[model samples]
Target: MRRLIKLGLGSLLLLALIWVPTSSTEATAQSQVSEIPNVYRGCWFQPEILKYRVRMTATTFTFGGGYYEQKHWQPIKQQTYRLSDQVTAGTFTWSRSTNTQGYHTIKVRGGAYHVKVSQGTLFVKQIRQGHDINGYELTFNQISHAAQVLSGDVH
Candidate 1:
């Protein structure tokens, strides 16, 4: 199943992120879980069309975790949401001056095709089961054991 593969790759990626570089086994045993990470990490997928047998990859780190989400989709009859709709979120450490923590910019796509992106605490995506649905159901998908690009002093 495609979901299985996606979940596996996401797990590997997280493990590699937590993996510490060491000169020996002893050094490997002394790594901390909250070390400063040095890269941008994200997850993506088009679950709606996975049955079509399309191979799409957003990010790949490794393979292996347990993450499950319950999803729901409802259709709106007369839509009025726009692409310009956006919401600023704060999911990670922040710089009081730059204000770029969490997601700096979230773009919405899909209200016309059953997928509408709105803003709240995080990037919100709604899915529907009809054409030109006015409203939609939504579920949040998150990759577990991930790190963020920290700006403030880590200590």
Candidate 2:
């Protein structure tokens, strides 16, 4: 009878050892989107201003990804326009069930914008400010590759 009891207890401990780690790992992965939003990294471009690159991550929005390591937008025809003195960051909330739809907001020192992105396509709904352009409906598409920065005006 004692042997039977000990065997049962050992089996329960073994089950707990296996179950705890598995559950914790699952929980961490599922909550990663909410905890850290800066996982989306890529180069995006606007049609009117194709020369300037917008590199967006889950955390920060870099206006001139190529021209300047700093944040600014340099159009092909226009001069270098500052986005913010400080770095501009972004945040998006994703649901556990859906990855197709999400809300993205970017707040820079000079400008702020809110967008809704679906399937890698961003629809700009509110453009509070921009270095050159302001308050317009715009859509940014993800480019297949990154662009090279040809010229820049250093601060």
Candidate 3:
């Protein structure tokens, strides 16, 4: 009887150990829209891709290309303007049930883009036809806002 009781307690402990990680991971993976209300609504420019700039609003995403000079980014015309909808309410998670990175998906123009926010930085990846293509990732930092202000691209 004592051995059976010990085995039961061990099984209970194992179950608890298994349960704790899953719950916390799910919570982390399921990011709320409120957590990133205005983080994405601005213009983004990358130095590596100096000829291009991206702008985001509450309901639209725009991509344009031009040149950067004297701490300013100039876009001659909006190349691709797409109506975008934010996937709120934790609608999607990529890879593995235990994954803990939270991101937002902007569906537009026959594909989607994933925007991940970490420490006030935006990491964006473009997915075309359900596959993540190479050389289609962007990283935005504090300098992006400075450039936006300088270029008058604030929204």
Candidate 4:
């Protein structure tokens, strides 16, 4: 009878374990929602020229799009990649460039780039060998549908 009771308790314990979700699952779900502020969530692009674009969501950051080359703006395919880590609240410093500093930041492409939003603009810069690359910095303004239509950006 003692052995039978132990087996029953073991089976009950196994069932309980199967029914309960582990903390890791909860953490992953929570982490999927980005830490970037809501004000920074949107698609941003250069004003006069569509040289580059960046889109931010509750869980993802996408960078790429129309690029300037050969002395003209060219439309390029955008690629989506995951942020290397959760965005944390704090300033990210890199060589004192104005666009390289912000109140919050996230890593991208295996820490190849640092992204930040400040004063309604999104800034992205590529990092190599622990330093920011010059001329590789990108600044984008939030896209406004109404403003774009009024500005003749949208037809």
Best by lDDT: 3
Range of the 10 consecutive residues with the lowest summed lDDT in candidate 4: 89-98
C-alpha RMSD for every candidate: 22.3, 10.0, 12.3, 7.5
Best-to-worst order by lDDT is 3, 4, 2, 1
- For model 4, the superposed segments whose C-alpha errors exceed 4 Å read 1-3, 14-34, 48-50, 67-77, 83-100, 135-137, 146-155
For 1-155, candidate 3 gives per-residue lDDT tens digits of 99999999999999999999999887765443222246676766554534456666654566656765555555677554434123333222222121244756665546666777678677777788888775666776545356555554664
Better of 3 and 4 by TM-score: 4
RMSD of 4: 7.5
Q: How many residue pairs clash in each candidate?
A: 7, 3, 0, 0
Estimated TM-score per prediction?
0.17, 0.39, 0.50, 0.58
Q: Relative to the true structure, how large is the alpha-carbon lDDT of every model?
A: 0.27, 0.49, 0.59, 0.58
User: 1-155, model 4: which lDDT tens digit per residue?
Assistant: 99999999999999889767676677786565545557667877865554566766655566666754433434577655543333343222121232324524454434456666667777777666667775566777865563444345567
Enumerate residue pairs that collide in model 3. Answer: none
How big is the positional error of residue 46 in model 2, measured in Å on the Cα after superposition?
Answer: 1.7
Name the lDDT value of residue 139 in candidate 1. Answer: 30
Residue 131 in candidate 3, Cα distance off native in Å: 1.1
Output the better candidate (3/4) by lDDT. 3
Give the per-residue lDDT digits (tens) of candidate 2, residues 1-155: 99999999999999999999999998886555342144345656664433545555544445542242234434443212222323334333322233233545544435554555567766654334433264454666775423323222321
Candidate 1 weakest lDDT stretch, 10 residues: 51-60
